[model samples]
Target: MTDSTAPRGGKRERLVTSAGERLHRKGVAATTLADIAQAADVPVGNVYYYFKTKDDLVRAVLEAQVDQVEAMLASFETLPQPVDRLKALVRRWDEMRDVIARYGCPFGTLASELDRRDDGLDLEAAGPIRRILEWAEIQIRQLGQPDARELAITLFAGVQGGALLAGALRDPNLMSGQVRHLERWIDTVAASSTQS
Candidate 1:
């Protein structure tokens, strides 16, 4: 018998975690609400109780992903050195490999899926991602140029490209290479901005 409060603490978390994993592994198109319900060991109706629809579940999963990254970035921001923060970001990303391997990056996969559609669901799904990029822009600006926002967008694009390739090639190493390339570019840009 489950504890009465288990639904809010354990069961709800399990459903979201399972849904995120499924979304990462198979993407939005292939994953079904029933699949998440089964993976989470929650009844189908219970899953619906937590999430009104499949899209709602997906949005929540994406929001969770964004929140994790945002927390990492926030911690890095407190470190006092811009370059160190950048390096910390990379390290945090490296730590995400297992999650990436299991369910892909929710932001990358969901953004790709939503690109082709113009529905409210797609727009709603993109909110967290947009906020992330916005925050990243602020960080990038601190590192150098007035147009740091654009640089943040570029970095986000590169990461997504790397993730997409990782899924397609079935090799996380591809993501490593892409991130290395991004690091180099960031270093050069940051250095140049400091000199100017």
Candidate 2:
């Protein structure tokens, strides 16, 4: 970027955004620079100008996802209670249930695929997931629970598992059910936390 205020609607950003779409739809190994270039409406040669290699594009997509997650979490902070913030997070995921049913959880799918490789990207792949779970832990702790970390894990694990099954079965309703159950369950946890 030329400056912090520069509009990110430029070719480079298009490439990264297009790459994220393709990667989420068609996994990393299957998406080519040409595919991203075509999707972004940039010439194949121009892709090399913005990204030296395919891995560079993948890393950029991961970084973009991290920024997205942070911005979203920051937005959730505006809610009054920790439980409300937590439900908002789940609601956010619920909003994407249809897409997740079609393409799986982008974060989970990409992270799992990258873990099979020896490249340093495996660590980068964990960045967004860690941030989400860590954010959840903070919220759970605010409920005055000593087992905040465990509860956070429980929350994330259940959601991720729901996403996986929703994708595998190509059923958005499955995710809807899961999220509804989760919201009710979070209420139960919150009620119990304050009591204990």
Candidate 3:
């Protein structure tokens, strides 16, 4: 018999996608298998067939997030100039200001929540953010910044801080403002590189 829970893709894929979205909105500890099943339109018992445990599902979600971050970074690389690439990244965030204001940065909020749990997957949960930071470092390095790594950290922190504040205040403008400031900072850094 064909499974009703299965979508055009597959039940497992749907479950993972549902879990990731729920986890982003509800967090790891709070999101239950039942919630994922409901979101995916699958039976609760069928969830166990795909993921033996909640941790297993969480790992899958993190892997999906890593893939998303890689794809985003790859898209940024298509830009001709490093500064333009970084600006593209900022613009990307600015475009998501509404979502960020509602739920904050998925990776940042998830990492913070998982870190607080002191669970073994804390590092795993942080993998996506780390990759983003490393990608930013490479972009900054391409711009010939002597402190590429430090500047990347600053950029990541600024984005995360803006995400946190925007979510707290429910203000999309706050995130847009931060994105504009970051774009200006990128220009300043680029100019300094030329002068030095």
TM-score on alpha carbons, each prediction: 0.82, 0.94, 0.93
Write down the TM-score for model 3. Answer: 0.93
Query: Order of all candidates by lDDT, from best down to worst?
Result: 2, 3, 1
**Can you list the residue pairs that collide in candidate 1?**
24-103
The model with the greater lDDT, 1 or 2, is 2
Rank by TM-score, descending? 2, 3, 1
Name the candidate that leads on TM-score. Answer: 2
lDDT (10s digit) by residue, model 2, range 45-139: 98887777889889999999999999999999899899999999888778999999999888888888998888898888999999999999999
Candidate 1 vs candidate 2: the TM-score winner is 2
- lDDT of candidate 3 over 160-182, digit per residue (tens): 89999999999999999999999
lDDT of 1 by residue, 1-196 (tens): 7775345459778888998888877878898888998999988887777777887787778778777767866787787856566656655545565566545676767776866777676666676678768777776778777888888888877777777667666677777877788788878778878535
Pairs that collide, model 3: none
lDDT for residue 14 in candidate 1, whole number 0-100 = 89
Per candidate, the number of residue pairs that clash is 1, 0, 0
